[model samples]
Target: MLHLGKPLVVAIDGPSGSGKSSVSREVARRLGLAYLDTGAMYRALTWHCVSHRIALDDAVAVEAASRALDLELSLSPDQEYVRVAGQDVTDDIREPAISSAVSAVATTLGARTQLVRRQQETIVRAGRRIVVEGRDITTVVAPAAEVRLLLTASEEARMARRGIQLGGSQSQEQLAVQVLHRDAKDSTVVEFQRAADGVLTVDSSHMDFEQTVMAVVHAVLDAVGGHRKNG
Candidate 1:
């Protein structure tokens, strides 16, 4: 694999259904870097709380759960897994039930603090050469990253993409709850709708998947210099 001589931390932040997860994973694969889906960490935490019947509104309980979260997730673009307390929750965390409750856990201030620390530690463990994507990655988790990007799309486009992503199972109302409402709740804590200073924004409202990916890749190359070679 090709490698940059120095650490190349690519931090990407965006709202729900904004293609942050898929695009960041592909960007990491293309750049030969590790991938960290910080949002999944929140989802996993939500799943844990729901499984244990912990009240999502109970901030103290949620924060305690965050600090004690025994979460193991895949850090590679090629593999996809999330194990919470040795239980494989890769598919469990993506359920609609978890989606509806994730923002509750994510927006808890104390919980966010604990998770952000874990995410930062994960970056250091990866030698700071990873593509991290989430709601607050660019601004909070890795503000000093070499490349900071905000991948976004129009709400309609985002909902459409999310519907397709979920295999057309969710109704329009369900999509609105999952995509728009969740964004609204999460935004109370993280400013992901607007790009922060020095953060590049790529609006994929009218762009296809390949086009959007190339746009992000171009932005990375422009910011960091040179195209990454494929292995």
Candidate 2:
């Protein structure tokens, strides 16, 4: 069972195309902890927008819709998925249209606040033993987390990984440009920047997905210690 006040919160934060989501999920599985893909929240919001024919740039409307979102973020031993108001938005969120626009959807204050509150509520309610993957969880949502790791990869390497994940023959350069631009936006947005201190930054540039997961999991567990210390 997931324990509260569980002492260890593995907050895996990184840029868009970095190995944050996949590796963090794997790490949580091996450790038998809950995993949350916050980026998928944004993607699902993007899907909501697409479904409603809303203007992607309108932050007020987006935030309103976000507050009304009946969203669920779920993790099991075998798979991860997200549903908005009981409908699966998993595949819909990964569409190129949604991928290109989620940053705008996520960058707003309303969106961030909504998600951050949900994030904090979930972690604390779950007793703090979870692996949360996102751009801002370490710096913003889970700053008090016992263990925070920044997973980063070289631009080329990240692009290659994204291309593989997105589809074959897609433009890595274009995706890289978008990812870098999103990074710049996220880090420089004055309020939503990186955590200044106490973040274990791990470079997954040269590591395979499993290798990266193992390294990060080792570091997080090493810091927190098993068998429930502070919880």
Pick by TM-score: which candidate is best?
1
lDDT tens per residue, model 2, 1-231: 234455567888887778787888888888777788888888888888878988878889889888888898785535867898899877888777777787788778787799788888888766677888887777778888888888888878878888888776567556865677767776654332344488888888888877787788678757865443332
In order, the Cα lDDT scores of the candidates are 0.92, 0.77
Query: Which candidate has the highest lDDT of all?
Result: 1
Q: Compute the lDDT for candidate 2.
A: 0.77
Residue 100, model 2, lDDT: 73
Q: What TM-score do all the candidates reach, one by one?
A: 0.96, 0.89
RMSD of 2: 3.8
Tens-digit lDDT track for model 1 on 1-231? 235657999999988888989998998898889999998999999999999999999999999999999999999999999999999999999999999999999999999999999999999999998999998888899999999998999999999999999999999999999999999988888899999999998999999888888888888887877755452
Could you tell me which residue pairs clash in candidate 2? 4-127, 5-127
**TM-score of candidate 1 relative to the true fold:** 0.96
Cα RMSD to native, each candidate? 2.2, 3.8
